[model samples]
Target: MKFRLLLSLFIFSIQHLISQTIDKEKLLEYYESQRYADAAQYLQSMYPSDTKDTKSLTQMAYCYMMSGKLPEAEKSYLKVNSIEPENVPVLFSLATINSRRGNKAKARAYLSEIIRLDSLNFNAWKQLAGYGENADERLKYLKKANTLNNTDPDVAYDLSMTYRELKQYPQAYEVLKTAIAADPGNFTLQQAQLPVANQLGKYREVVENGEKLLKENTDANVINEMGQAYFYLKDYQRCAALFKTLEDLGVRNEGTLYFMALSYRELKEYDKAEIYAKKTIDEGISNHTSIYYTALGGIYEQKEQFSNALEAYKRGLTFSSSPTLYYRLGLLYDFNLKQAKNAVNYYNLYLKNKPDPEEKDQIEYAKARIAALTTTKELVKK
Candidate 1:
């Protein structure tokens, strides 16, 4: 009986090898020609999918992936994963597909499994690092990745950037130096080095290195750092010029504008200084105060909270007597609160502000209401 079973198993193995050889030849005709869609079709037709081997399923999945048939690829990979649960390469392929599909949690789970099986797996750790939700979590994963492979340019860049985001400037600077040394012609590494160098008060180094990097397409971060470096070096004229370039690029932020203002002042350009100082305040705070309050009041009005709407408008008047606020207050009192005297007073205040040409309808309404309310008050008194 044992001899019969052994002979039957050998016969089955020989048949399977013959079938696999024929499939491989047919598949290579399409696959070697880079016709992945054709190869996927051929692979899927090889046998009933329910009986296909895991190796054949994996090959089909790879063809599907190359052909941009993500759903088909995912299904094939899933079947392979179930059959060969301990296969690391299959796990990695599953993670890649899930990530491409925006299934971040599933991708992370597969990556976690890879590391559990082989803790020294560098690609799994690096890919897992990006799944972290916060800077601290990202920093922890990135540190692990960086340790596993310090010479990896991408890992070094990400580690340095995470350190910089957390205000660990010295560590950020050090990481980039090692990566840059390994790949000296890397412009991205050079770009990242500027801000940390400036933060560490290495102004001369930032300027000397930054000047060679300036181009039509230089990033705004690099320009901002160069502006700061020039300012600290007391090169006021060049500082103002660099900030002006940022302004032209539409990259002006509050800090850059404030520095621009100071740079102009140091260069004895008072008018430009005043202009930039006003811009700094507008960018930093206060300029949108009235608009913010107006939107808040409108939200309250939408919720049918008339009292809250009135209060929001009144508070906005205290910040800036924006004509729009006066108009809103008048509308709430006139239509909702039934306070004729309060409505009339606010309408008159709104008219006195002489709002813009766009407020012509509002101005006309205010004028007509004031006249009607004043006459009604006299009649009530009588």
Candidate 2:
């Protein structure tokens, strides 16, 4: 019985040695040719599923992955991971396979294990960020990833985006700045920084970086950013010019028209301001038409054009009865136009909208003015 057991053990040892001794040149040739399926098959024929050879199993799994036989690859990788439980590459491969197969929970599990084993794993954190269920969760993962390896451009970009979405503009700007410094030639990073700079009131920085980006690509977003920067910088001429280019390309939206109107108004060019103001109203969304009119009225009011402001507010009432517009109309009539009865009518309209709590001061002023306007006392009584 002892002799028979020894013979069986020797045979098993020999079989394992022979399998390991097989010429690997053919496998190399297959890999060199990018014939991944052939490589996988070659390894599988030499190494059985129950083989204890981790190297062979890992090689087979990689080939299966490259050959697009994901199930086979996953199985092979699982075997390798069982043999070498701390193998990060094996875990990463499993994570990738599960992610591609839409098994997010499994993918996240693998990634979490990787993070638990190697807390500074930058790619693991980045992957977790990608799998995050919401913006805040994404931000949490991305911030960790960025801290792990801030020089990684893709992670930097994603982290910057999450920061921007959370309205954490300063952090977004800092991340993007570091990333752009690391990868000066990445135009996407360059373009992304424009809005962050704008949000932080870094108007000159927006103009500087934005101008450089535009020279490379005429992105409408970059152009708009430059326009906004120029407007805030009080460089109204350049602001109008940039938005005009977007308008000429027929890519103009209400924001474009609004910016153009404001630019011209700031430049004391009332006719052009009115033109863009009308364009803004034309692009007004349904049932929200009064918003554009209010903006237009504001532009005229800022320019001390009281009659035009009156015209704008009254014309706005044709589309929708906006409480803010009603209040503005009442004020104009009470102060500028000297029509107390007209003022009281608009005050009544303003009161009926039940303005938000934020507008309590405006509401109180309207009520006091209504009571004090003696010429409208008869109208108020009726």
Candidate 3:
């Protein structure tokens, strides 16, 4: 019996040793070729139980991370950390996982630990300066990162964001300029730069560039930005004119219709506003429900077309689940048609939804109107 046990143990030891003796080079080649699933399977099949096989274990961890097997990656990477406590790359990889999993604070702490270990880690410094931090601190970290890798597009974008947070729009523009100069075909940089220009009230810059781009190759997004810039500058006529041109050019999308409604509403052209608002609905624009309904209802109510106002409010309610629709319905029924019973029903519906706290007093006033109507009905019966 003792001899049989000894033989079994010897065979197990030999098998383990054979697996440990597998080549690291072949595994890495598979990884580099982007065959991550194959690499992971190969690494796992030959995993070494030996304490000194740190490289094999770390490779297994990286393979798991690459293949999106995060739980397995976490376990393997933890093993790598145990073997190589000073491995900055491994720690940064763990930090990235934490960030992707939405644990930003943990990710930041891990990044800070990396910075502590290697003070010149540019990527770590740049990531640590992202949004919701003090602008000065972000700038300091980003500037440090840029010093290490000035030509990095990501670093340039980070520095631009830092400057934007500081409200230093000109500096942000310059940083974007540097980034674009490095990679002129970077559509992302152009998209990011547009918002910074808008934030800085650089309307003329937006209009000029956007208009030139429109002439060369017009796009819906660029045209929307240009329209917003004109709207910001209070150039209602020009804004309408531009959107009209877009409409004529067959860019009569929901967004353009919404903008047209806004422009016409701003100009106090309620009839035009109603036309475009209806167009927005017909085009299935989801976001314009509030203003579209309110504007349309207001236009009809102003014209004393009570039935039309009621229909507009009801249509708006179908698309949106807002209590404001009920409130508007109640007001139109009470004031326009003098349908006190129907008005009371809508007012009660609005009250049930708890519309807004500021409107609480107004709702109480509406309740008084309902009570007065009830008393009038009783008197009429007498």
Candidate 4:
């Protein structure tokens, strides 16, 4: 029995070698002659069990992918990756397909891992560098790639992000100056260079290009960014005026309203601040409405209207499922309204949301209040 088992394994190994060594010329003929179905059928019969035949698997995956058998193709690629985790070609192919299939996060994860494994992979660096939220990390990778291969303009452009992210104004300005020299009037480089300068607190850069942006691009982003630069330079009146201009010019988005209210708050124009805060809600900007709600509640609290403040906080709770609202409401009830039951209710709600490691003690205190409220209620019923 042992001899038979060993003999069977030997035969299988030989047959697998035979399958893998099948003539490349024949396979190419089958593929080029549009015999995908026949080629697949023959390949499957020859290697009934999956094996580490990279070329054969790649061909089969391509056929499967082209035939719209995406699952089969994906499985084949997974088998390839299992066999060779560090195969740049396999990883790149898989990443490209994942990206095309709209699995951006999955694509990003794969590309990021590949870059981590092989930093000199310029394709991976270039593709991932375009991700807006991850521009900083991507730029780091790109700089490494540029150090490896200096002639690539994409590498230079990508590495320019360090200036923006690190707020290295002069270095960014100098690098961007050189990049623009290399590729004068390239739209992306031109667009990115100014922000790097702005971040570095180069107000002169803003002043120099601000007029050009306003004249050439009436884009809301351009306008908002210019307004922000002015705001940072302590030009509060101009900031408020620009925000008001944006609002008047049909740029009255939530961001515009939020900035306008902030500008007003900074300018000590509390009436205008309240007006914009209320308008932000009226415009149905629900995501950041909590901040505005807290602002309005704070205003009411300052005016000594505890009832209105509490109601505003409660309204904020409805708009946002934020724990901060409940926490503030709890504090208001506990300290100002002298309503322990309401305080307990809000505290419990806050506790439900407060799971941060630093907030464990606060969470415990809130839970105790809730438990106390339950006990008191039971005693009253009795």
Best by lDDT: 2
Using all chains and alpha carbons, the TM-scores for the candidates as numbered come to 0.80, 0.69, 0.56, 0.47
Model 2 agreement with the true structure over 83-138: per-residue lDDT tens digits? 89989999999999999999999999999999999999988999998899999999
- Highest TM-score model number: 1
Alpha-carbon shift of residue 8 in model 2 (angstroms): 33
Instruction: Flag regions of model 2 displaced more than 4 Å.
Output: 1-17, 20-23, 286-382
Task: Report the C-alpha displacement of residue 61, candidate 2, in angstroms.
Answer: 0.7
The residue ranges of model 4 lying beyond 4 angstroms of the native Cα positions read 1-53, 66-68, 78-86, 97-119, 125-142, 146-178, 213-216, 227-245, 252-382
Which parts of model 3 are misplaced by more than 4 Å?
A: 1-38, 41-47, 130-151, 158-168, 198-204, 215-217, 227-239, 245-382
Give the better candidate number (2 or 4) by TM-score: 2
Model 2 residue 239 CA deviation in Å: 0.8
State, as a TM-score between 0 and 1, how close model 2 is to the true structure.
Answer: 0.69
Question: What are the C-alpha RMSDs, in order, of all predicted structures?
Answer: 7.4, 13.6, 12.1, 13.7
Better of 2 and 4 by lDDT: 2
Clashes of each: 0, 0, 0, 0
Candidate 2, poorest ten consecutive residues by summed lDDT:
10-19
In Å, residue 221's CA in model 1 sits off its true spot by 2.9
**lDDT, candidate 1, 1-382, per-residue tens:** 6754553453344336325444444554575577899977875665566854776678778889999898999899889888888789989998998999999999999999999999989999899999999999999888888888887999999999999889999999999999889888888989999989999999999987787777535778888899999999999999999889989988888999999999999989999999999999878777678889999999999999998998889888776879899988888887788787888889988888868879889999998987887788542553
